[model samples]
Target: MEASKVIHAIYNDDDVLMHAVKKVKAAKHHIEEIYTPFPVHGLDKAMGLAPTRLAICAFMYGCVGLTVAILMMNFIMIEDWPQDIGGKPSFSYLENMPAFVPIMFELTVFFAAHLMVITFYLRSKMWPFKKAENPDPRTTDDHFLMEIPVHGNQQELHDLLAQTGAVEINVVDKAH
Candidate 1:
């Protein structure tokens, strides 16, 4: 977590930022990261990131949750220890299935919520005891940041950023 070299262009205009990103990308320079105060539509494509797989992951996770809910409720209410306090039959799944819905729904929600949280935590590398990694505070408020690594033509990259109407530019040495 020490020092590494990073060059960032700070922009106040989202339009300018968008145009700038497109220009640099079209020129075939890879953009390392983009930080905006608010979401910008189509920025992901401009940054050359493929569409996210989170939706598919969510669907799969939800299915697992629902399946577990159904199985658990079936085992507990119908199979292991059946009781007939209300004189309702528990011998048939289809007969008592409607009544078992509430617990099934509850468990479904519980599992989905828990598993999604775990997935998010693991995917984002976030842990309760882990230290946070954040950029400058100003970038979160009024400014947007576009970080480009210094591979080659560092000066030309800075110049290109300035030409794109960046209000401020900074070269950071974040090497460890």
Candidate 2:
């Protein structure tokens, strides 16, 4: 198979890059990817990307954390060793649930946050010791990069990107 050609359009400003994305989508071109120096509001919607389901995963993780908290508190306070917590020897998990409320809340937040981070990293194919996939290093600091696949109309695409105020344009063979 032949190597695929791509155009990397660099933008100095996020507003210009956003406008360019709209124009490119209006022209029915497929944008492969975009890299921005910072998070741009509404960029995902502009790119027509599906909403992420990470929130659902977070909710599930929170539920697991809550369950674990309940079971752990029950085992430690009621089953394994019943203690006189807060001058009340309520040897019942349900009776002492009010005291454990803070613990449950903390554990739920902790699990949701940590699990979401791990899930995001795994989903993005990022792992410890993995090389970066950024096409240009400037995108991490002061530039935005838009990657568009070349489909035998490089000149037209270049013209369009130039019209959209791209600071620089590069044609590269994308390595898989």
Candidate 3:
């Protein structure tokens, strides 16, 4: 793989980072990546990234969980062992659905939360013992870092980043 130079611009505040992102986009510069200590609202939109489909996935997972819960409850309460609980031997899932509603709801939330996390981890290419990709450790605490590829316009890009209120800027060779 060929090594290419990239510019790393560090910012202290998220507002400044957002403003710099907008300015960089307005100038037609492509932002490779941005690392922030916390979630910055509207940063994805400003970076022109596509909206995530995690919500849709979560909904589907929830549906699956609800179906499983319904089937399991029906089999257990109605078909497998029709018990005379509270002297009500209905043997019908519909009749006993009210009692199963809580289980269904809990399973739905559990599946959505757990599956969504696994899907996110897989989709993000994260795995056990995976090497960290963070360029700056400070970004994990308070600062924000923006990465832009340098294409023979290092001086121009450096000056532009500096004008956008970057506290520190560095040119580093990155391998792809």
Candidate 4:
């Protein structure tokens, strides 16, 4: 494999990072990635990334959970073994629907929360025991880092990053 060079520009403030991203995009340089301590609003739009579909996925998962709850409740209470409880006969699912509402709601939220987290982890390629890919530890604390691949214009890219309020810039050779 060949080793490629990449520029890591460290920024202190999120605002500076956002402006730097816009300037870099306007200059036609492809930004590989950006890391921040917390979610930066409008960063995705500035990076020209597509909107995330996690919300839609969570909705679907919730629907599945609701269906499961309904089917399970029907089988257990109505079909499998019907019994009278609290003066209400479990002969019909519709009659006992009110009693099942808590279970349905709980299962829906549970599935949506757990499955959405799993989906996010899988989509991000973050498997269990995976090595950390963060280039700088400070990004996890209070700093922001922008990574851009060098395309034989190191000097130009370095000068531009410096002009964009980067606190520090380093060119590192990355082996892939």
Work out the TM-score per prediction. Answer: 0.87, 0.96, 0.96, 0.96
* TM-score of predicted structure 2: 0.96
Clash list (residue pairs), candidate 1: 2-175, 3-174, 3-175, 3-176, 4-174, 4-175
How many clashes (backbone N, Cα, C below 3 Å) per candidate? 6, 0, 0, 0
Expressed as tens digits, the lDDT of each residue in 88-165 for candidate 3 is 885799988888899999999999999999999999999999999999999999999999999899999999999999
* Model 1 per-residue lDDT tens digits across residues 1-176: 66667888999989999999998887788888888889999899878898887767777777887898888867887898777859896786788887878877777677777887888899989989998555667777888899888776789889889899999989887554
Error of 2 at 130 (Å): 0.7
lDDT of 2 by residue, 71-166 (tens): 998898899988885698857887888889999999999999999999999999999999999999999999999999998999999999999999
State, as a TM-score between 0 and 1, how close model 3 is to the true structure: 0.96
**Global local distance difference test of model 3:** 0.95
Candidate 1 runs further than 4 Å off: 1-4
Model 2 misplaced regions, further than 4 Å: none
**Cα lDDT computed for each candidate against the true fold:** 0.83, 0.95, 0.95, 0.96
Error of 1 at 146 (Å): 0.5
- lDDT for model 4: 0.96
Best by lDDT: 4
